[model samples]
Target: MSEQSPLDLAEGDPFGPHNLPYGVFSTPDAPEHRRVGVRIGDHVLDAGAAAHALGSPYAALLARPTLNPLLAAGRTAWRDVRRALTAWVTVPAHRPDIEPLLHPLDTVTLHLPYEVSDYVDFYASEHHATNVGRIFRPDGDALTPNWKHLPIGYHGRSGTIVVSGTDVARPQGQRKAPTDPAPVFGPSVKLDIEAEVGFVVGTPSALGSPVDLASFEDHVFGLFLLNDWSARDIQAWEYVPLGPFLGKSFATSVSAWVTPLEALTAARVAPPERDFPLLPYLDDADAEVPGGFDIRIAVALNGQVVAEPPFAGMYWTAAQQLAHMTVNGASLRTGDVYGSGTVSGPERDQRGSFLELTWNGTEPMELPTGKRTFLEDGDVVTMTAWAPGPDGVRVGLGEVTGRIVES
Candidate 1:
């Protein structure tokens, strides 16, 4: 499917899908610092070193000491960098602009893409919502009174968002036992992972300024892989009149690279048919069947693939989510990230989280080696995404992986 290279891409290869997403990394030898780079096949193309060779805005940002400049530069800068990098890495014959900064993938430390000011996770998946709703309310009216009319979201803790390779600590909170009326706080036993995608906010919106669907594209800088680990028991007890607080606030992991919207152009497709017609502010005048993106997404345990799904599985489009977020005049700043809630499909195996996939631990998943109710200590859960393109698969987002640590 890759138009650029006829090379066979091992399922595990990071760049073979033609994704050139950017990130910051430093090897174990240099753990204290982070440098910019992009994923190509299994290797990382160093961006900081490459910037010196290319006369682009990224080079200027790379020349700076920190990634703050790059993050603050917004959507325009991100597009320019991606366009230049795509051309340089794929067709280097004519553009002699970038040649020096390329380096091997192993020598770097991948850091969180941006200094997130605030994190908001949305309930965007229809199947996931219905499944979760059935658990809470059995009457089949899984959707809340306001769910269909608007995009519902909960603000999460930003300090806890970690990059790949980081260890996620098991969280603890209050939960009402099967027999007991009182609540107890303790280590979360039902810890699970949620397969999600996070969009980085490039431009800042002024307070009280409503964002319309037509102008929503401009505010989005790019997309990245996200895994919002959950403490089901803790969440059950804590989520009452209000939504997730301690259960969700503890840790949220995301991929280091940000895939600019432009790179996914070819893969854009119309979203699933809406359950109901959207309000005027949320309507997209010109949207095709795949207008959003057909990025193939999956989650793996250790090195084994667990759930293989596609981005096309999402019920609500990202543009609709962004527009809904700003409809109330809520100001969005640079580095603000929005999460596409757990992406799930109609099939049981295609479920994104262990709770849904394993039927809330009622049914354990049988791996090739064994079975698992939830992630165990040293178990690494990775979420990877990419799009098939005319020229090789245009690889954008990388994996968001984390090993479960001891309590």
Candidate 2:
């Protein structure tokens, strides 16, 4: 990892020597079987094959069909495996043997890297929260009294979480219009996308003990692009007392490749200033990446780039979210996903979801597809991101894209 790869690497390539993200893939020749692979440019280095050749201690772990084996192995094992892979790819002497194992990205199919155990979506962005409050709670304050005090979040269903490229079937649920006397059951009309960043948990914590702020990196495996697809109308109708159910739980698409957090060392930045003093449990103190990451993300609807929601603008950082989630004695499990909900910034163009950008369907976005107040049946949403890499390089994040199909 210290030296640049002698292999051909292009400018603005996200999978340079510095950012070797991991995933699972299968070729058409072996469609029934899948194995671990590491992304490098347009090629995928078959981790199972590479590890076997290198005689790495983690060879057996890397050979698994999913990443759960490597994830179950602690942080040190993760780093060691990454180092071994990096050395094999970058070192010129090893290329002769490794080149044959490399597979073209297009020639293979990517699968969900791990089994999602639990999912939690946090309303960490100030701009997004304020917009939601303004749209829904118009006569009341934009932010709740305890909004700035903690990282607000709710548990999500992991069973419905799908990998990238999976077609999201528009969900059917009861949605009551504001003017309607009774709720009607039908397919959602206000289906939307929330451009968010996802943190993957690798190491597990105990049942009663809490994970502190400084230990966030120790448990977190990596990061990926996540689209928390929403049924805005359904959410509006049912999220009054408890929170989102069918509206938010139907489908969520995640990118296949997960970039190791170490690759984003240079992208770390202090989170936006907090207005209220944080409690001792939620306080930010000594840590590796103090506040959060500056992973630049953009939202595209039907191939049109509409927003550049800022990840660094989140009022609460990922580290804080981890600390807050475990403070109440909840144990951390492998494949647990923590979503940094819709990353809207202060500017109008930086809004993350259609509800905010179009002002709750009042202002429509005139795109190549047509005037879109919300997602139509054929609408496709894609999210891509870049994080600062070493030596002034920009590391690319794997993208999550999904096309909407009728249920």
lDDT of each: 0.75, 0.91
Whole-model lDDT, candidate 2?
Answer: 0.91
lDDT of 1 by residue, 1-407 (tens): 63433223365454642467667766676576566766666566667666666555567675543455766776677767776766767674623444334445555566775778778899888889888888667776988877777778889998999887789988877877568879887788889999988888777889999876666567777788899999898888878879898888889998877776766777777777777777887766455334467877888888888887667867777888888888889998887888999988888867889988788888888998788887777888988877756555455467788988887
Positional deviation of residue 161's Cα in model 2 after best superposition, in angstroms? 0.7
Q: For residues 1-407, could you state the per-residue lDDT of candidate 2 as single tens digits?
A: 55543367887677887999999999999998899999999899989988888788889999999998898898899889888888988888998778888898999999999999999999999999999999988999999988999899999999988999999999999999989999999999999999999999999999999999989889999999999999999999999899999999999999999998888889999988778888888888555466689989999998899999989889999989999999999999999998999999999889999999999999998887578898888888999999888888998999999999999
Instruction: Looking at model 1, report the run of 10 residues with the lowest lDDT sum.
Output: 2-11
Q: Candidate 2, residue 158: CA error in Å?
A: 0.2
Measured by TM-score, how close is model 1 to the native structure? 0.89
Model 2 residue-pair collision total: 1
Candidate 2, pairs of clashing residues: 14-396
Model 1 spans with C-alpha error above 4 angstroms: 1-18, 27-33, 54-58, 65-67, 90-100, 285-291, 391-396
TM-score of 2: 0.97
Model 1's number of clashes is 29
